[model samples]
Target: MNYPLIVFRGLNLLVVLLCASLALGAGKPLTDFSLEELMAMEVTTQAKTPQRLSQTPAAVFVITADDIRRSGAVTIPDVLRMVPGMHVAHIDGNKWAVSARGFNGRFANKLLVLIDGRSVYTPTFSGVYWDIQDTLMEDIERIEVIRGPGGSLWGANAVNGIVNIITKSARDTQGGLATARAGNLERGSGALRYGGKTGDNFYWRGFVKYFDRTRHHGLPGETAEGDWDSLRGGFRSDWYPAAGEQFTLQGEAHQTRAGALRTEPLFTAPFARLNDEPTETDGGFLLARRSWETDDSTRYRLQAYVDHFQRRRNLLDEDERRTTLDLDFQHEFAPNALLDITWGLGYRVSRDAIDSGQVITYRPSKKTDHLLSAFAQAELPLVAERLTLYAGAKAEHFESVGLEVQPSLRLLWTPSTRHSLWLSASRAVRTPSRTEEDALIVLSVRPFDPPLPLTSAGNTNIATEKVTAFELGYRGLLNDRVSLDLATFFNFYDDLRNFEGVPAAFVLPPPLPPLDALFTTRNSETKARSHGLEAALSWQAHERLRLMGAYSYILLHVEPRLGEEDFDFSEEKTPRHQASLRAWLDLPHNLELNTWLRYVDALERGPVPSYLELDTKLAWAVRDNLSFALVGRNLLDSRHQEFPVESFLKNSVTEVRRQIFAEAIWKF
Candidate 1:
């Protein structure tokens, strides 16, 4: 299969079916719900209060549970691809590069991800390891995605966007459920969940899930060496002691093992060779939260969590162990009718122990770091429902860097009940990570006469990366059945991380070998800027039919100072243009059909050809509690490459092949 031919054929068939249905049928559709029902959806990720989607000031997107189920998505990252401004790419079978607007790479550092308020980003690399980010898809309530800077609320690394995964409460899932799926690429997967009442006022739920994934196709259609598997289990408990107070506790554990083929440099003869290595990872976390409301309309919440993470990998000859503890509190009050205020405080501490080898080594074998933050925000209704202003700032102290403050100002104007306009300006920062501050990596070991070694050393004086962003947005409901959201933003970045080489040669004792100079981390004097626009539209054409479309455009420019090396790959790695369209149809007899079409522009660095992707899912409910589905993904092409070749550690590129899967779901 290839582009245009297969894509046009599929689209033609879909158009004919849709037109015939609309011209022949005369009943209600699945989208019979009113537009007010859609706007009334509440999201809490934006601020302290759960506000309607239309009232938020930021460029926010909500992925509902129905969207997840209908899309036939197996993972969180896969589901995120539906968002308008997000950039999600598969690097390998077990790795993903996900960001927003621009700045995408294997280690995308500017995006922050959280699960039930627990940060999943690694401080060592300032990125997320997607393989272990697993959850029961059916248990997810919704995913809130903010496409612009959220540093004033979420702190560091939230420079680009924020993704918050919120799960259903135990009280809402008081039943038993099971799912089993199998496919050529997915291999096999299964999950079991059970929820019930633990006491008169306490509800609890537990779940266990496991999956195995096969390898991808190489450049020449050969099977690549990328296979992975994992096992995970978790539980949650919710207690309601009174009408105005609630308590919740949750914990999860996961173990994952994976393998990949890599070509690594050697110190002796045969400088490089292809080899396969096994990677092992495991982690666990426990969290607790309490919330209460007073008679005076004041709300308070306290949350705490502890996490333990360990990764043993042969690819880098590295073993890492980390433990973290976090505590946070928030208070919201309405002192007056026109003023709403929120204050929050947080503290986090992490300790890491790394076992290094010839590949990379940390200067300090063990280290501990602390981060403390305080933030407050106020919302004032300038003219009641017509105009409003929001102002907030956060001050944070890190062990490596002193006090840093992030601030934001936003204004919202409601011209009518059906339309809203919002504008915002914000400042955010990305703090230095462990890799940039205290790591030594051996790029290559040459087996020459003197056994010379090339190594890169981390710099302790590396400065933080900062960004100032301005955004504008418009949201409107054209009629009872149509709605649209549009947003634009410009971001200016300074003090970005760059590499500078220092020429030096040092001779060691007779027992050791000599080393040559290599590049080190530094702050660039130049600056970078990016501007983009995102638009999304939805239409409920019929009672049983709905259509959604999204488009995004981004332009990035970087200026390197005089006499400095212009070496930034972010602009080339991210796509400049992307678009997607989806359709959801509810047929007779408990049958549902969903289709998605997406396009991504070519990468500047890879010079990879642009591609179109098509996906479809057909599902039937045999009974009220039992269902089955058949899903097809990447149907437009037999295979396509989504990421460029990575030669740093010799991680090659693999093509994603066409996949079909069958799933069975049961609920009681």
Candidate 2:
């Protein structure tokens, strides 16, 4: 009855239904020649410059590749569900739990993902494995969600958000390209690309992609074996020898096969079941970057990367391999009209191997880890263009928290150019992985008559899972055809992560005698508090239409720490009110229509109920480089279950049917 008071009465009835739908369109009649071309958009993960998203002071969001081709999404967690305080669940059929603002599960350890600056999380279970994170969503080129706590310029797990992704260079993809798709649960897909130029200063591109999916429905709804498939390829090169120097290189490779159910631990007595495994994965990566600039306020960058991964499952008799090596450096300077600077340095090394049998193990079994980081950010202009100040700090050294420090402070206020205001304070951390410091698990076997074996151990003195955040933002354009964005937050978490159950009872006197029970992993002087509200609105509903909406509300409170009262499902499994609505039309000769509507509120621990979804896309343009489309997704549910029933794969609950697709794109 008290779900954070129904998320504050659904955010006060969504601010009175967004002021009665903007006072019923405030007497429409304003079209200063528009095709909804508002332009002025740029972001760079919060402060690596490229500002303007109404002068970002954080709580960012930018997902464009034409908003992922008009959002009838395909993958990337359904294009991050059009983001607004994200939490995109869908546990099986290629697992995803995606989080932001509140720790949603499936390895969600405070979200931090990147792909142009490479880092796919997963320090062996520190999140992000969204089925191998593919690319070619039309060469990305956007996607910069950064909700809260960026750990003073990205260090540590960036605490609660950060997903960069950025692609599309190589002179913005130049030559031939192709794409094809077919669906009923995406039963086929394809992609191919090529780009070239070598005359004056390099530029090259290459790509290949594939996909297959189908099979989901369980819990009496039949068919569920988690079907999946994958194949990939990639290449890139870009160089420019003059005017601000630049050089780059890229690489990719992939292979996958999936089918899972895997959950075994039985010794008769209705112990455990669900087995049907066949999983394989392979991975690759290579990256290099070099940059220099003398204008645009000075700049510098140098980067390096190499990664490799592998996984195989035979019903929890897993086999895994991982390798990583990374190096990075950054510098930016203004040194003039009121200072603006940035600095960075990082180094990483990871090596892993496991082939353990019988349910899990990692005690040493080959390991190597190292991480070092440094960061700095600064910008101060007391009133040069209407008050601004931002400061940052970061320091990291890992091998189980040997050093850590993260800091931030931000402020921006621009009373004019159509409003803006911002405020922030931050600190973030979440470190400790390798399955929480060296895995080894069992967790159950009790049934009397010689069989008691509950276990769980792996904790090299765990510590570090902290947050401290506060933010407030506002952005308004109110006159150029409406625009508004508001953000609010308050978070404070500490030492979170709990488990400690010890009830010793062991004996092995003469020949043999046995009994066992033990559990450990704690550091929860538990404390959690979360508060939120996010709002977005954009309207240009005239020249060829455009409308956008977003809403989010979240509330979490926890105290525990004294005999931890069952940790109330860690924020009740996400979704404390949510919304998104979108529309875009521009038809007439070169047709295009897009739609998206969503609402979610109800997942109090997957008592999974509330839902409302509708996605659509229809396109046409058979000339300037071909195009055709049709996409429909969950058109009001024919199956649901976004997540729940996954605690070690308890049948990996599934169901997310209803999809339709047909697409084609070509360019030459």
Candidate 3:
């Protein structure tokens, strides 16, 4: 009985069997689809136009591509591993510290990652360093995970979530595809892609990749273990000389080398100061969109972009460059009384360069930054088949918060066909980075004048990081195999830019010195609360087997107002308990079988004593472009440790113990 009284009596028997199937009218909520398949699965980035997920109201989560190839995972943060208030970890091997809903670790500055819509963050650590975040996971095609506060439509770091990553056009990838893999720990890999057609309004695609990874051992004898190698290339094209107008071209380039291991002790003292270091980064973007459709509902779009970014690393002596020019436009009015409308305007400019080791910075003497924004959204349509009301607002002007207004209000209700309800109220922000506007501390540990040197410097007038979010959501399916997506949030913080510790009382006339108490970056007054519950299930029982699962339970509190330092271990590193079981077996000569079983839970730090991880997958297909695979990770080897300020360990490392891999694919 308990268990929240069986979840409030199973949500009151699912709202009384969906109101007795809408009093038997039986056709509602896309009754069995149609309206052109519900406008091809209604979705307009959560309220720009058409919306459906039983009638949208944020808290969305979709990662299709067959759930990223059935979660065997090949990046994209391992397919965002079953979303649901995501917080995927894995801090090494190209680093990763994704977050959503709560302050998560490793520079997870309020989340807001996009691709294809371009904007990979990292304008000097804004977020996302997911180890050179590679793309081309089969050219994506889905991955829109929004979890609370999109700031009236993506503004100011989206405040905790927004990971769009849409792609898959080259006329829908018209040709070649290939992949090969090997492992003992992901030791080798390969990929190639090809697409055609370049006349009658161009369309093209090209991709090439190379990879090497084998370096992660560290534990005995303590030798550096940071091996990595990478090479990447990219291309995308599209041109529609007529018909609604569209033009897009994209580019990417990469180079990486690492063996990195050095933590100042003496220029040369062999034990673990390895190096083979060479680092590089490249970027390119060009966008132009023009849309005009005076009928069938109306449309308008005008977008522009130009980008060039570069990064050079030498362990720590930065050389960064960024040049950006972006502009935006969008307009869709009419669909009248549903208030269907969307608005837009945007601008951006950036430039950065820094070079000075041992932590040092020289204020951004104005590389450049300018962003003016405007946004509007409406959807109000209540009672024409249930209820819905969405509102929006966005007004930004920053060269330093000259103006700011991010608003949101949403509410959706469906009184039939499998009830659903949602509500939201938001105001999100999280700006000021360069580690809180240029953090510089050049040299320390040179007290006697040998190992450490000067020290202390940082403060570029830091300020900009605010939030006020509130949301509530619920989804339903309760039958024909179950389904549920629930949400809850309450985040209220201000300024909040950590790193503070100031104490100094000096008098150095005795030898050659004085006070030395410093730890800059400040802006406090914080708060947090991210309630949760996300459930997913699909039990076809038999009929080719199926039993999917996903569970999330979050309850972060973070509120220590008197003498800080309480960000709560982010509640034991994600995965409150994730379960999985999938099958599609149809074994009979021609062949076709797929399998998966996963369970991840148990994790801790602070008294450190918790662990558990297991994964599995198997596949065999002889059609639909062939397939063959086998992959296993941890498989219960269990040992765990993924960042706890592990900083090149003295212990608290090793997250994978047993791994097996193999893969092959082809498509034409």
After TM-score superposition, the amount by which residue 19's alpha carbon in candidate 1 deviates from its true location, in angstroms, is 2.2
Best-matching candidate per lDDT: 1
How well does candidate 1 score on lDDT at residue 628? 99
Encode model 1's per-residue lDDT on 222-324: one tens digit a residue.
4376688999999999999988888999999999987766666566677556657667889899999999998666999999999998988734667999999
- Residue lDDT tens for model 2, 214-294: 776775544477788899998889898888888999999999887777666653466566668667888889999998898
The estimated TM-scores of all candidates read: 0.96, 0.33, 0.31
lDDT of candidates 1 onward, in order: 0.84, 0.77, 0.62
Q: Please name the candidate that would achieve the greatest TM-score relative to the true structure.
A: 1
Steric clashes per prediction: 4, 0, 4
lDDT score, candidate 1: 0.84
* Model 2, global lDDT: 0.77
Better of 1 and 2 by lDDT: 1
> Which scores better on lDDT, 1 or 3?
1
